[model samples]
Target chain A: DAGVTQSPTHLIKTRGQQVTLRCSPKSGHDTVSWYQQALGQGPQFIFQYYEEEERQRGNFPDRFSGHQFPNYSSELNVNALLLGDSALYLCASSSGGRREGHLNTEAFFGQGTRLTVV
Target chain B: QKEVEQDPGPLSVPEGAIVSLNCTYSNSAFQYFMWYRQYSRKGPELLMYTYSSGNKEDGRFTAQVDKSSKYISLFIRDSQPSDSATYLCAKKRNDYKLSFGAGTTVTVRA
Candidate 1:
């Protein structure tokens, strides 16, 4: 069985440009969450999608958005990218659609798409 | 202040030695704690997870959480060169989003 998979292992974009990164969640998983990991730092949550709707979001601005398809794949779109937006974008998949009680379900992550803004 | 604070240690240790890593969180409401390992140019992989204040051991890894102190720890026993990577500590409340600490990079020298 394949784990989480992300497209375009690496990307280069210019300021004010938009970039879209894709992800396919692990088999049997229904939820997808995106994270941004800057240099020398841990990943910061961007947002999470369930049932094709955003259920949770982080501190990111409106420029960062995401979509989840019925197939459980996800796409992260960053508009008007800034130099600071350059980082490794990670996609993680979990089994629960909506979490309740204790969250014991483990999340699996992909290798991540490296985005560099020049 | 950050929700979770971890020392970013480029810690170097000899192979076969025990490696210790720690992180502290500002929120007492964080109930789920986890430790993730990430290699260079790679995404983090979950290594250990615990919901309560105690130690959960799996092979060479042991995850410890102290709710009263709002601290978490991960210990690697008899580490190997392959263990060299950045270790991230993450915490989450009853909500869906996970808050992470700055990762600690470890290099196990042979």
Candidate 2:
């Protein structure tokens, strides 16, 4: 089965422009999570979508938002993108039951979209 | 202050060497610990996960969680170049939130 898949493997955009990144969760996965990994940094949680609703979010600003469709495909939208917004946008999918602390599942990730805000 | 702290090391080691990566968190409430491996320009893949305190071993990867010390570690045995990547330690801060460290870059020379 295909693992998490992302779109626009690489892209360059001018400052003030907007960008949309897409992702399809791995097979049998029902939850989708988005993360941003800057150079020399680990992936930072953006938010997680379950049952087509945003179940949780991180310390990101309003400019960063996302949506998950009925089919478990997700899209991340960033408006008025700044240079600092340029990073490798990763999409991760988790499968399994939920627990108190964690969702209690293993996560698979997409290769990620390399966004370069020029 | 960052919730999780990890040394971003470009740690180099010879083949078959044992490698250890660690992270510390300020949030004492964090109960779930995880380690993720990411290659160049690629997304991170789950390497290890453990709940509460103790050690969990899977093959050459061993994940240890010390809740009392607020520290966690990932050990790789018989390392290979394929294991060369950034190892990120993460913890669940709340019910559905995860906080990740800066990641440690490890290069295993084959």
Candidate 3:
């Protein structure tokens, strides 16, 4: 089966420009989450999408938002990017939603998109 | 203090050496512990996971958790150069979201 797949393996944009990163969850999975990882750091939770709505979000600002389609695919959008936004954007997928608490859900990740803001 | 703490070690070791990575968390509510390994310019891949206090072994990897001290450990046996990567310790607080450590980088020299 195909694992989580992310498009535009790499991207470049100006400070005032906006960018969108896309993700397709693994087969049989229903939830998708987004994360950002700066150099030499671990991935930080951005937000999670389920049922086409955002279920949980991290410490990110309003400038960062996402969407999930019925097919369990997801997109992350960052508006008015800053140089600090230059990092790796990662997408992870799990099988279910809220019930994930006690289920020992293991999230599968994509190769990630490298976004470079100039 | 951060929810989870880990050593960011660019630790270098000779081949076949045993490697030990550790992380400590301040929350007792964290019920699941996981270890992920990420190569350069790539996403992290789950390596091992454990729920309770004690040890879980899989192949050359062993995951140990100490709920009492809120500490977790991952041990690698017969380490190879290919084993070199960044290791992240993550904890789930009875919820789906994960809190990750700063990640420890390892390099196994041939």
Candidate 4:
């Protein structure tokens, strides 16, 4: 079975522009999550989508929004991108949402898209 | 202070050496601990996950958690050049919120 897949291995956008990154979950998985990793830093949680609804969110601003499709695929949209938004946008997937005894709930991540905002 | 603190090491070690990575968190509510490995320019892949204070081993990798001290560690045995990557330590608290530390980069040279 294929693991999580992300589109456009690399992307470049100018300041104030908008960019959309996509991700397809692993086979049999239904939850999708997004993260952002800055240079020399760990991936920071952006938000998580389950049942096509956002169940959790991080401290990101309103400019960062996302949608989860019925197929469990996801898209992260960032509007009015700033230089600070230049980072690797990572997409991860897990089977089911948070609950007891979740088998590792290990999120399989894709080879993130490197977003460069100039 | 950051909720989670980790040494951002560009640590270089010869092949066959054992590697130890660690992170500390200030929150006591953290119940789940995890470690992720990320190659250059790649997203992180989950390496190990453990709940509460204890030890969990998988092959050459071992994850240790000391909830009493709010510290966690990831140990790599028989480190190889292919093991070279940045290791991140993360904690999941309420609502499955994940807080990550600045990862430590390891370079295993043959």
How high is the lDDT of residue A7 in model 2? 98
Q: Per-residue lDDT tens digits of candidate 3, residues A32-81?
A: 99999998888899998989999889999999999999899999999999
Instruction: Go through the candidates in order and give each one's DockQ.
Output: 0.78, 0.67, 0.70, 0.61
- lDDT score, candidate 1, position A58: 96
Error of 3 at B73 (Å): 0.7
* Per-residue C-alpha lDDT of model 2 across residues A6-92, encoded as one tens digit per residue: 998999999999999999999888889899988887778899998888988888999999999989999999999899998999888
Best by DockQ: 1
lDDT of 4 by residue, B1-110 (tens): 88899977878999999999989999686367889998887778888888867889999999998887888999899999999999999887756557889999999999
Sorted by TM-score (best first), the order is 1, 3, 4, 2
Judging by lDDT, tell me the better candidate of 2 and 3. 3
Measured with C-alpha atoms, the lDDT of residue A83 in candidate 3 is 98
Per-residue lDDT for B51-108 in model 2, tens only? Answer: 7798999999999988888889999999998999999998875466567899999999
True contacts kept of each: 0.77, 0.73, 0.63, 0.63
For candidate 3, give fnat to 2 decimals. 0.63
TM-scores of all candidate predictions against the true structure:
0.98, 0.94, 0.97, 0.95
State which candidate has the highest TM-score.
Answer: 1
Per-prediction interface RMSD in Å: 1.2, 1.9, 1.5, 2.4
What lDDT does candidate 3 reach at residue B23? 94
Give per-candidate clash totals.
0, 0, 0, 0
State in Å the error of residue B44, model 3.
0.6
